[model samples]
Target: MAKEKIVLAYSGGLDTSVILKWLKETYDAEIIAFTADIGQKDELDGLEEKALATGASKIYIDDLRAEFAKDFINPMFQAAALYEGQYLLGTSIARPLIAKRMVEIARAEGATAIAHGATGKGNDQVRFELTAAALAPEISVIAPWRLEEFREQFPGRAEMIAYAEKHNIPVTASAAKPYSTDRNLLHISFESGMLEDPWFDPSATSNKDMFVLSVDPEDAPDQAEYIELEFAAGDCVAINGTQLSPLEVMETLNELGGKHGIGRVDMVENRFVGMKSRGVYETPGGTILFTAHRKMESLTMDRDVMHLRDSLISKYASLVYNGFWFAPERLAIQALVSESQKNVSGTVRLKLYKGNVIGAGVKSPVSLYNPDIATMEADPTKAYDQGDATGFIRLNALRLKVGSGVEQNAKK
Candidate 1:
């Protein structure tokens, strides 16, 4: 029988490093470390060498940044998805992309099982596993953080550090401030460690160090910067006058918004795993993308269609937040959302200053903004009718009038 090859999603972090070593020892298996680059920037630094040194037989560092932003991020932006009306789904959206690549690696490497470092209590476990199950159900999933043997052997970060030191695996994680962060072009998310406490004032110097994407709002440029974003069928296609790919748009906007302190959100969000977690996220690009997209929608989208879409927006947002990216229901919702955005092609001008994203102006070739119909000072001419509204209003209010008439008759 062949030794079971397990493709572990390794991050070169203490938890993943420990998982890699533990998998080799306990399962007596050949472990292939898999790392997905979804715009995590320097997080993928030296990951291959680190994985190999940490006892993995091989490593696959997958760069899915372009695909992530184009396929995943842009679609979510179209819905203006805000999980529970707060979280921007920066971390949540990245999880499925990473997991999708992990399953692909498992197939290519002929690995029987895949693994991750997500704890049992978090939403990421559900996100990663649901994706794997939806994509490749034949493969086995090994979640060591939830396993009894792994938990007893190496309980926490201290044990993982000691194990790394003993095994000669180099790591930057120490006992001091082990705040876990996930970064991408759109945002940087900080959680765990000192941030675990709900009441922990983020203003404290201790927690202040957790930020990576934005500068202080007060220190932001005194002048607000106005820029125009062009969208075609819900995806941002250009910035100012330059056309760019979806990925490039996100990267460009992130840099512009971050410098101006445009997207910083701190809130206690409910996890899909039936728990609440406190998280601080700086979603610079996403902030700009959503603001601009809505402005464009207002100019081009039909009023009735907009109202219908808005009614289902919360359900769509919840699905993405709860890790249903691959689910059929999400696909159905996305289809309708996409149809509504057919005329959402346009340019939206926005002003960015501090943490606020203010809308300036919006225009579209398919714009529904009829100046002649809406202008207050102009006559609508022979094409319009005012006397028709009297009957229209009376007919619509028939239910209320009939109820009142019946009450008066009964009293008499």
Candidate 2:
């Protein structure tokens, strides 16, 4: 009989490197390591060699940056999905794509089981498992963090480090630096370690060096910079007059936004796992795109349609954050969001200063903003008659007038 094959989502990080070796030893199965390159810059360096040396029979390092931006990030931005009105769902959005690819690789390699390094107490476990459940119901998911034997063997990072040392598995984790970070094309998120304390100030001098994507707001350039964004069907198509692909757009905006110290957010968010987690995120490019897209919609999108979409913003955001990216309800909401963006094509000029994205101007070919009627000065078109206000107000006030008359009669 052939040995069982297990495909593991490998990041070449401490947790995953250890998990790769542990899975090989514990299950006595052939381990196939998979790494998704969704724009983690230097983190992908020498990953293949490390995985092979760490006992992976095979490794897949695929570049999914463009797909990540176009398929996942673009649609979410169209819905203006913001979890709890703050989190951009950076880490939350990346997991489904990672898991989706993992399932694809498992099918190609004929693997019977898939594995991930997400902790039991975190939302990642739910994301990975749920994606697997939805995409490939036949394949089994192995979560080591939830197993008693695995937890007992390595209860803390110290034991995992020692095990790595004993097995000669190279890892970057150390006792001194304890926080965890997840990075992708959309954003980079920092959590755990000292960030677990809700009151811990991430902007303090001691934590200044921890930020990877943007500079501190106070240290930004003294001058503000202006940039224009072009949108097509609610997605950003160009920046500062240069046409860019989805991937290029993200890369360029990250550089620009980072220089201006934009897209730094610190908030305590409720995780899908029923726990409150404090996270600091740097989403420079995403912030710029979101602001520009919103401004564009304001110029082109109808008020009622925008309001109806806004009504579902919370639901849509919750669906994405809760790992239902592939679920039916999310798909239904996405259909409506896509329909709403048909007229949301325009250009928006913005001023980037320090950490603020201030709108300078917005215009669209199909803009509904009729200056003739909206202008305060005398309207030469006479599009809106001033005499119409009397009947309009009287009709609107009739209910209030009737209620007041009833009250007066009762008093009398």
Candidate 3:
């Protein structure tokens, strides 16, 4: 009989490297390592070679950059979903896409089981398993962190390093920087180690090297930069009058936003697993997109429609943050969000300066703003009729007046 095959979500990182070897040894299974390219830049370099050397029988690297941006990141942006009003849902949003692809690879490779390197304590384990269960219920998920045998073999990073050395596995991890980081196209997040403390000041002199995607706001250039974003039906189509694909748009904005220090957030967020975690994130491009998208909506969207959508922001945000991206409710809510964006086409000009994304102007062909009705100048020919004010005000105030009269009668 052929050996049972297991597909592993491989990042070519220290933990996953160790897990790859451990899975082969523990299960005596054929390990197929898979890596998803979601705009990690140089991190993808030498990934396949490393996975192979680490005992993967086969390696698969899929570039899901465009699909990730168009399918996952774009919809989340359209909903204006932000976890805890600060986190851009960078790491949170990427997990579902990775899990989806992992399932696809598992099916294609005829694998009976899939595995991930997410720790038992973190939210990624929930994100990965929930997506897998929702997508492919038949396949087994191997979570090494939750297993007693796995934990006993390698208790910590030091032990994992020792095991890697013993097995001739190439690893770049060290104990010096205790923090771990996750990066993709939208943002890069840092947590664990020194970032575990809720009160840890990332801006302190000792932690100056924590940031990766952006420069320090204080170190940013003194001169401000202005750019215009063109949106069509709630999607950004161009930046500064230059047409670009969704991925290119994000990459371009990241360059500009990072140069100006436009996005840097540090907060303690409530995790779905009933834990509070502190994280530092640099979401340069996403910050620009979120700000400019809202500016465009302000010019084109209806007041009540925007308010109703605003009420669902927290719920939608929770769905994404809690690994419910593949859930039915998220799809239903996304339909409503898509409809709300029918008139969200417009252009917004913004000024970027020292961590500030300031809106300069917004315009749209279907704009609801009527300048004639808003002007202060007195004109008899205009739509404004001053004589109608008294009746309008009286009609609106009738209920208040009636309530006041009722109170006065009761007092008497």
Per-residue lDDT, model 1, residue 25, is 91
Q: Model-by-model lDDT, in order?
A: 0.86, 0.93, 0.92
> Can you write out model 2's per-residue Cα lDDT over 57-124, one digit (the tens) per residue?
99999999999999999999999999998888999899999999999999999999999998888888
Write model 1 residue lDDT over 1-412, tens digit each, in one string.
8888999988898888988888999999999998888888888888988988889998888778899888898888887788888778998888888888888888998999999999999888888998899899999899998999888887767888888899888787787765778887668888888788878777665555567777777777999999999989888899999999988998899888878877888899888778888998889888889888988999898899889888888888888877889999999988988999888998999999988899999888889887866666554653446668899999999999999999999999
Residue 89 shift from truth in candidate 3, angstroms: 0.5
TM-score winner among the candidates? 2
| Residue-level error in angstroms, candidate 1, position 391 | 2.6
- lDDT for model 2 comes to 0.93
lDDT of 3: 0.92
Candidate 3 lDDT, 256-330, residue by residue in tens: 999998899999999888888889999999999999999899889999989988999999999998899989999
Off by over 4 Å in 1: 204-208, 381-383, 402-412
Q: Give per-model TM-scores.
A: 0.95, 0.96, 0.94
> What CA RMSD would candidate 2 show?
1.7
Worst 10 residues of 3 by lDDT: 372-381
Clashes of each: 0, 0, 0
Candidate 2: Cα lDDT at 192 = 87
